[model samples]
Target chain A: MITIRIPTPLRSMTGGKSEIEGKGASIGELIEQMNADHPGLKDRLCDEQGEIRRFINVYLNEEDIRFLTGKDTPVKDGDEVSIVPAIAGGAHD
Target chain B: MFIIPSDIWEDMIDHARGHAPRECCGMLAGTDNRVTRQYRITNILAKLNEAELARFDQPKLSDLKQLAPEERADIAFQMDARELSQAQKDIRQRGIELQAFYHSHTMSPARPSATDITLAMEFEHCRAALNLPQPLHVIVSLEDRDHPVMRAYRIEASRATEVPVRRQ
Candidate 1:
């Protein structure tokens, strides 16, 4: 079982549940399985090209999956995945 | 140029002042580069965890001492994700569009900085791909505290153009 943490923005689609448990071999399959159960989530998480939205960051046990293997990143029992919105914009001066 | 009524403009400035020393942000709904209404969203960066964030019924106190000196020193804005999503829905239900993004510059000038340009570019990228209208960036600078300066701009991938602000 994989524990996926949902960001606050998409909490409404998840019925206000912050975390969900699902089973999948990879991150991609987990997203698919979750979307199958809860609609409108995949669209917000992935773009039309099936890529993660630019502002959304997925972390596997504190490691960014994007810098590692992206959607193909493996998942296993007791693994924790966090979806965080990027904190951008500041005084670059 | 964006058109904002004197009352609405004053309200935004008041919001900026209320959160002085720490940047504040809110959403504006309207059409055609003119603002009709505004919704203030809680800035969540001051919190340290999601559980603390979930307790929205409680008031949030942004104690500068809680953050590192550097983070406290910088003028940045981060809206609570849930509040932002709800505000979007509210705008849609009102039959209006999110015409502008508003934030404050606590100690700096009323100008879009490099970081603002980058974030605006990302938003423009998504909007352009979806064929949506780009929203104006409204910055309220409280450098003088008593005499706040508010300005508007259109930010693209490379440059930011100042848009004239006028009373409606």
Candidate 2:
């Protein structure tokens, strides 16, 4: 089972669970499984062109998936996936 | 010339403080001496790895200790092209001129660092119209709110000017 960490903005879709477990041999499969389970998360994860959005980053065990094999990056049981979106706002006075 | 609003400047300072220990980068935008918009570009903190941090040199204790003040100031205007391009494009698309690049100097004086000066110099070299009438370099140090220093300068002649930038 691969554990997928959900970001704050998308947590509502996952019923507020910070992390969810799924079965997949690769990043693509993991996302596909997530979409099947969550129903509306796929659209948020991928843009209209089906490409990953520029502001969102996905990491497999702290390593950016983009630097890996991208969507084809392999995953195994007990692997951890983290999703982080760039945050904006706030400055010191 | 673009002017950054006080509120936005405050927001940027807050963002910088929140990301303390690492630098925060963003774009400043405005038209004709006023900055109406600001975009948080990226968090450099998110990109650093253990190996990179291990090799990090503290600016306060670096070879800068042996350099003349003028030489040290000159080094602050250089910046990376890719980062400049990203900032420029973001501002341009919004119909705002690329006024200045702003970043926080966490754990250090709010003054422009050697890296900042290098970026400013690079920007002046790559951009056309050196004769354009506007201040291209802006440095804001959030150390003291009452007298938060905002210095403006032209990168070509290396002349400094003091301008009042109101933060809301």
Top-DockQ candidate index = 1
**Each candidate's DockQ score against the native complex?**
0.15, 0.02
Candidate 2 lDDT over residue span B1-168, tens digit each: 345677887787776666554456666677776778776665443232222221122452243334453332212221222343455556656776766556655434544444344334433432332221233555555455444455554444433344455553
When only the first chain is scored, the TM-scores of the models are 0.91, 0.91
Interface RMSD of each: 10.6, 15.3
- What is the DockQ score, from 0 to 1, of model 1? 0.15
- Model 2 whole-model lDDT (C-alpha atoms): 0.55
- For all candidates in order, state the fraction of native interface contacts they contain: 0.27, 0.00
In angstroms, give how far residue A31 of model 1 lies from its true place.
Answer: 3.1
Q: Candidate 1: which docking quality band?
A: incorrect
Clashing residue pairs in candidate 1 (N, C-alpha, C atoms within 3 angstroms): none
